[model samples]
Target: MRFYRQFRAYLVRRKVWEVTAYLFFGILTTLVNVLIFSVAFRLLELPWPTSNSLSWLVSVIFAFFTNKLWVFHSGASGTRSTLWTLLKFMLVRILSYGLDMLTMWLIIDAMHGNELIAKLITQVLVVAVNYIFSKLFVFADSNSG
Candidate 1:
């Protein structure tokens, strides 16, 4: 309980703008992911998993740059630090991508391939998971300024 309070206070002191900027980055990536996935699947006749994986790959490429500059602001003092940070970034993304795949599977299989609904459902679930993981794990550093 006290930890949660301290965390909230830390966020507030850092300025809500930081949080807003991070959210905006996530929203942009999610929009692109869903747009590409839906368009490719519905109009271009791509398979569900194929479209989902491709869209996620595209979003991840964009996310790497955006998060480095905006979300984490990792000074990354040297090439080694940069590489280390990117390793952590990629690790976080591995889990995020896995969640995305699993969510799509549930939507497609368990929910019966109602694509319109499945796309929307999986997008929401994956975006929330990505945001929480990115903020709490990927971009978390005491000196991430």
Candidate 2:
């Protein structure tokens, strides 16, 4: 119990708690994306691109709220400020979506790779990219203006 408390204190002191929370939520978001994609592509017999887009839509919405409330703890209030934050978040995510599509196209269409494999790989890349964008631009304190 003491060791656990010490470790927890260290994590907080080092500001790793925020990252740990982000990673936890990021995993959940990824699971949501992959599950939605799998259902749309395999069960519903949708095309890879369509399935990918559908999954992206759902995951982005999930990510936004989680990131705001938990990950970054933006604590942004007011209708205008919150809406502005949402808009910026969506814009950056749209850019990442384009990257996702391009990566999928290159892997599955051009390289003749497996669609599921392509999606998993794309998710890894997209998650990293999104984290950077969220930290630097979307959820950044300066951008709160």
Candidate 3:
């Protein structure tokens, strides 16, 4: 109860309900990725990395739609404007993906850290990066100075 009260206070103070919603949708995206990967690799007997790549692709598409419509409520209108915003979103995600790989390599290989711990740290960094890029670049209001 005390923890819940403290969490609620933090949410009210920060007004970061979007972060909460993003996390909710992120979980759904993870589930979708895992389900697709499992079906492709185990049931359909696809190649090892191919299944993973396909799953990631589908999940990214799912995430783009959900984040634009639900999480950030992007105001980009017109086909060109929307496409531009999507391109920015994809670019940011691609950059973050590179960062994730670099972080994992630095932590696990260079620093001799555990793989799971390195991955967790990398994921946290990626989430922060994605949120910042999405808010400032992909979803920023064009009219705002």
Q: Which prediction has the highest TM-score against the true structure?
A: 2
lDDT for each residue of candidate 3 in 56-144, tens digit (9 for 90 to 100): 57877888899888778778879998899889988988887678668767986789886446645665676678878887888876332
- lDDT tens digits by residue: candidate 1, 19-138: 666688878987888888988888889998888888888888888788778766766658887778778777878787787778778878776777657767766776677667766766
The residue-by-residue lDDT of candidate 2 on 27-116, one tens digit each, is 999999999999999999999989999999999999999999878888678899899999999999999999999999999999999988
Against the correct fold, how does model 1 do in TM-score?
0.77
Provide the global lDDT of candidate 3 against the true structure: 0.74
The per-residue C-alpha lDDT of model 3 at residue 32 equals 80
**Which clashing pairs does model 1 show?**
none
* lDDT (C-alpha, whole model) for all candidates: 0.75, 0.90, 0.74
Model 2: clashing residue pairs?
none
| Least well predicted 10-residue stretch by lDDT in candidate 2 | 136-145
Q: In candidate 3, where is summed lDDT lowest over 10 consecutive residues?
A: 115-124
- Compare candidates 1 and 2 on lDDT and give the better one: 2
